[model samples]
Target: MYELSLIALIMPLIVGLLAGFIGSKINKSFTHWITTLGIFISFAISCWILIEVFLNPFLSFNQNIYEWMSIAGFKFLKRVF
Candidate 1:
């Protein structure tokens, strides 16, 4: 089981952000298409994750992408489970 923690999760967010940035700079005609494409990709990834979970009975795979919060010596991982 492979967990999509680091690169996988951030890609869609980046795409959406890029779309918004470009949308504001350009005309309104292409804005909807770019936003729609980003949403579609995000939906597709979610579907794939659901499919992987459904196929595997013992799904305990997790990947720690980053340390989201740190207080003193404690480290919190942003994990995909």
Candidate 2:
């Protein structure tokens, strides 16, 4: 269970990197398509994650990847209790 959750967390990152690498190697016309495909794939993964979380409400996703706390000394840690 833990391992599956971990994979869920990491899959989008791996896909993004793989798609970016491929896009960089391709021509300009295909680059847009490749990057768009990557974005679409990531969006699909997010939708799947949302559905999975809804189905299994006990599993918690505690990842906080945004760094918006340092803007004008705004503290996020205190606000998210």
Among all candidates shown, the one with the greatest lDDT: 1
Tens digit of per-residue lDDT, candidate 2, span 28-64 = 6776666566567666766777788889988775656
lDDT of 1: 0.72
Candidate 1 vs. true structure, TM-score: 0.58
Task: Give the alpha carbon lDDT tens digit for every residue of 1-81 in model 1.
Answer: 254533356667776787778878887768777767766776677778778879996877767889999999999999966
TM-score of every model versus the real structure: 0.58, 0.46
Model 2 segments more than 4 A misplaced: 1-25, 63-81
The TM-score that candidate 2 achieves is 0.46
Best by TM-score: 1
Give Cα distance to truth, residue 64, candidate 1, Å: 4.4
What's the lDDT for all of these models? 0.72, 0.64
Candidate 2, pairs of clashing residues: none
